[model samples]
Target: ENIYLNGAILGMRKREINRKFDEIVDFSGCARYIDTPVKRYSSGMTVRLGFAVAAFLEPEILVVDEVLAVGDAEFQKKAIGKMQDVSRNEGRTVLFVSHNMAAVRKLCNKGILLENGQLFASGEVSDILSLYQTRSIEKIKSKKIIENEKLGNAEFRVLSIDAISPEGSVLSIESGVKIQLEFENNIENKNIAISIFIVTLEDLILFEAPIIFSSDNNSQKGKYLIEWDIQPFLLNSGTYKINLLVGESQKYIVYKKDDILTFEIENALFDQGLNLNRLPGVMRPKVDFKISSL
Candidate 1:
């Protein structure tokens, strides 16, 4: 009833409200509680109902500000789909405000980045998202150790992790990056295996490198330094974080740390002809392409 009343107040005719009532209820997933009072609804339920009412009313413009953050994942997806339908098929305007870069990138064509109540940048969504990610990476303080807790019987202790370019300068897409890891081994007899995970800012694990122990020298009880080199043109231009894990041959994990180091890979200055703008995927590998006049 409140949904219908709100629809009426928003200039929706009775016939129009009746036509879209089922859809609004179904979309919000609040059919069971349709008869219940709005005061008894949970925060998420309220948000869902409100959004459903506003969206189904078919207004000229819709303003949503972080409302989808309250609902569950399924509801959020449906809401985003509805918004897309409204904007594309119905030719309506949706003024969405959210800090979710991934969602913004998916829904919006243009982006406006605001900093300290002032307009920072407004342009293509991808470019704005890249700039936003780079700015976020810049704010992360580079720390030596993220957590002080000893992991797994104190057998292995991570000392430091560093991400540096081959020339020991700022990282770029064209630079071959090196990951240096220093750790202290407490056990002598047991073999230790180290794995490094390259994760995006969105918490997606792109790929992992596992350094397995094959010799007795590597299992010695002492401080050790290991370096992993990532060739140029392997990773795309984005902010990435490192997750470290030290264990013994898939048996058990001794030490595990997330976000031990955060680094940004800037776009290469040189042009690659047709591939000018940043590629879509997480990786931009250098693959051999043989073009023939066939």
Candidate 2:
């Protein structure tokens, strides 16, 4: 089975760094920030302390949430390097969740993507980040009606994407908007891959869906419809776009990639207290959490 699930790894290597581990952590440049109040430390310092503690504990599988984003630049690098050390030299596993694909690509040998809290894709870092980069940018753009476009080495003449009720509407201001995407997939092969992405105006991807493929395209011809039955389009109040593509995994030529179809989500659309402004990292899929009182 694919690893990196939340509860799979039980043994965590913890460092009793109270005295001896503190010396090691101090050498790691953590002395400058340890014992400081959480509010007083810089973002990077927090990460450094967190890394120091996690390393001292020596967890078999290191699980890092979005806390990486809170660290400073130098500390981010340090934290990543420390995590790499734990995973490699110690032969322990690491579960990292971050929107920074560059970091993910640089540090992790593997990748796991969570959408609406559900595990959507997990595999080698390159492929998983590729899928994430592709789809996460598609959700925020406005769907457009276009024709005759080329991606990579192929040219495609397309139509438009549509929305079905109870279907999530791509590039819309509302959540829970159901939608479908129809395009003229003018490609050469029967087996084709497609992925969508939703991105912010700053070109940051909000999230992405798994690589959806067509194994049943009978006629590889002029115009076609790609139905996207998206029901729960969970997003915060932000401007977004939907990017579409038709390509094969990793190496296949992209017929349409990063076509920005746009949307603007209003703040009032959500109910009171619903807008916690705390969307978990980038991947917003539902996560399963069980709590035990300490």
Candidate 3:
């Protein structure tokens, strides 16, 4: 009934509402509760239903604000597809706002950034998202200390994590990068293993480098620095985040911190004509290929 009422308020005819009623209910996955009062619905259910109605109403312009954040993964995927259909197939416009950069990159061709209730920037989606990521990375202090109790038992204190080019210069796709991690061990006579995860901004773990202590070697109470090197041409041009994990014998975690550091690798100048930054996948290794005449 509320869906019908909203359709009426949106200037939709009663016949049109009836025509799309079943589709709206199906899309929302609220068929079982279609007859129930909306006041009894959960927050997710409410948002799903509301989005379904609004999206299926055939409005010339749709304004969606963080609606995907409330829906489950499946619902979010469906909602994105529906919005794309409305925009592409029906020749409508969708103005979407969200802090989820991955979703924004997937859904929008253009972007408008706001800061402190004022327009900060507006341009191509990729450029706007890159600027947003750079700003966020800039806000993170060079040295981050683990102060949250819920992250770990405080068995190990992370002093700092840094990623930079091998020569201590800016990182580029053609440059080998080094990750330097400094931490303090608060306990003695325990076996400690450290794992560093290189992840994408979308929270995808590309790979992990583990430093395992030998069985005979027990960790001592002291500060330690570990450096891991990534070869050049191994990673594509993009923003990458770091996750640090300290564990006992690589089985039990003693401390863990996500997004402890972030870095960007600019595209190599040699590939200026290739646009390698837009290439798919997390890695761009230099592979050897053999070609022969058959």
Worst 10 residues of 3 by lDDT: 141-150
Output the better candidate (1/3) by TM-score: 3
Q: Model 3, which residues run further than 4 Å from truth?
A: 141-154, 165-170, 210-215, 247-254, 269-280
Q: Between candidates 1 and 2, which one is better according to TM-score?
A: 1
Ranking by TM-score: 3, 1, 2
* Separate clash counts for every candidate: 0, 55, 0
Best by TM-score: 3
For model 2, residues 77-167, the per-residue Cα lDDT tens digits are 7677778888889999888877776677778887888898899988888788667756654543322333224223434544555333352
> Residue-wise lDDT of candidate 3 within 1-294, one digit each (tens)?
899899998999999999999999999999999999999999999999999999999899899989988978899999999988988888899999998877898888999999999999999999999888777776553334334323345578766678989987779877978999877787777677889999987677999999875446656777888899999989988888989888887667788778887888887637656654457777888788999999
lDDT of each: 0.84, 0.57, 0.84
Provide TM-scores for the models: 0.69, 0.42, 0.81
Task: lDDT for model 3, please.
Answer: 0.84
> What's the lDDT for residue 145 in model 2?
31
How far residue 271's Cα lies from its native spot in candidate 3, in Å, is: 4.6
Q: Select the stronger candidate by lDDT from 2 and 3.
A: 3
Mind giving the per-residue lDDT tens digits that candidate 1 earns over 131-212?
8877766655433332444423478877767899988877888897899987888867776788999998877798899887
